[model samples]
Target: MSWTLTEEHLADLARGAALLGTGGGGDPHVGQLLVRQAIREHGPVLVLDPTEVADDALVIPTAQMGAPTVVFEKLPAGTEPVAALRALEYHLDRTADATMPIECGGINSMIPLLVGALTGLPVVDADGMGRAFPELQMETFSVYGVPGSPMAIAGEGGETVVIDTRADNARMEWLARGVTVRLGGVAHIAEYAMSGADVRRTAIPRTLSLALSVGRAIREARQANTDPVARLAEVLADTLYGHLRVLFRGKVVDVERRTEAGFARGRARVAAMGGATGQLELVFQNEHLVALVDGEVRCVVPDLVCVLDAEQAEPITTESLRYGQRVTVVGISTPELMRSPQALATFGPAAFGLPYAFRPVEELVPA
Candidate 1:
């Protein structure tokens, strides 16, 4: 089913996208404000079902690329994504029929929506990654065979750089990352241009709707004085992401974080409450990559490692984590498409340089 995305839905969308972002994908607050501004000016943007898109329609995926922490001081000028889209279209010598998110988590989730509203293009409900990943090539669209080039990156100052890495997706990330660094550690991107048929085949479907639902569920649960984490799990049970496990509940004891190589790299230790034994240690590069409980791997990408405020159930981003905050670490299984051998090689534990093999979160933390 298709729907219109209005400013009214931005809050819930951001909240849910932050959770699915798994502590990466740029800051949700920034993304939400950007989308809200665009929608207020251009009216509600239409969100089309992937099946509704014509086979030959040109679908261009757009997102912001940077360390989430950098976005705090380097706010978008609200024209970057549109600038990137126009540049890419000028390069391809063709207009895009629609815009879609490269990743459905964090600020990237809202970039395409901003583009759609600004340009009067419909937004596709699907995305390249059901959850966020640090690198450009980690998208399922690339893993499933879409080339991520003839891409464009745009800065707040209206500078646009077009890169065509041909068939080398990793090279695209290399070049884009270098350019992003030069552009002051942040830029908006339009890449992985493909036909609607390609989107239907490779894109993670209905993730925007899923995010909105999850966010709304949290809000409604809080209003009703019910357990929001339990509501979040219930809301996710029917989605492509099948399970949500609260692996640890505790107070953040320590956080060692730094911005390096245009990415946020860090470790966070959460100790069990009430003087219980064990600690949940999170190691991340932009997004949470692994969760270790007393040195045992409990959750690893491409599965989600989400940390939520224990009482409010609000998802916390890596850049926002602070010592002494009470957090509930939840692990969510990725969609089946993300668990395939090819997808795993692209973004699994091995891809992140972790020692463990890819394991479903449900199996890792049995109910």
Candidate 2:
């Protein structure tokens, strides 16, 4: 079945995307604004189930590639995402039947929505990555054999470039990263073009609706004055991602962050409540990659490490971390599809240069 997405859904959707983003994917606020304006102008977008797409229909995934911090100072002109899609359609000499998110976290979750609204195309609920990753090739679409180019990248000023990497998705990332950096550190991209059959075979299903549910759960919990993290855990418990665990509760004591090589790289330390005897450390590249408690690995990449305001349960992005804030670190297990040996090689601990081997969050931080 298909559903309509109006302005009413942006807040909850953006909130969920931020949490699912695990501190990366750029902030969803800007994307939210762009989506809202597009919807208000062009009317609500139709969000379709992957099953609703014809097996032969074309689905193009779109997103923004850059350091999350850069989007703060370099706001988009709002036309770039759709422009990238149009450019790709032109290059392929065929129109896309629908658009979908390459990543279902942060701003990337909303980019496809914006494109759909502006272009009058239906938006697919599935995505390449169930969560955000710092690099282009980290997507399951790439891991599962979809070529990432011929792809198009568009800038805020209406500039567009297309690349054909053939079968080297990693090379595609390398080239795109350099181009994104050159475009003042942020740009819109449309890539991983696939048939609906390929989308069903590889894309993570229903993540957009999942994000909306998560956001709504948090909002309702707050309205009822209940524990939002607990509510969040309950919400995810029944989803494809499975279990969630609260890893630590503390006050942030230090943060070191910087934009480099098209990513926001940083680490944050949080002391146990009241500055007590233990500490939790988070290392990240755009998104939370690892969590350590007293130097022992508690959660690792491929799984999700999320930080939320202890009081409001609002997700905190990597760029938003600061000292003196009260937070709860939560870890959610990744789907088994993303944990296979091949997928691990593409985005696991080793891929990020972390010494630890891959471990599921449920195993690493048992509830």
What lDDT tens digits, residue by residue, belong to model 2 across residues 68-144?
99999999999999899999999999999999999999999999999999999999999988999999999899989
Runs of candidate 2 exceeding 4 Å displacement: none
Error of 1 at 151 (Å): 0.4
Q: RMSD (Cα, Å) of candidate 2?
A: 0.8
Clashing pairs in 2: none
Clashing pairs in 1: none
Best by lDDT: 2
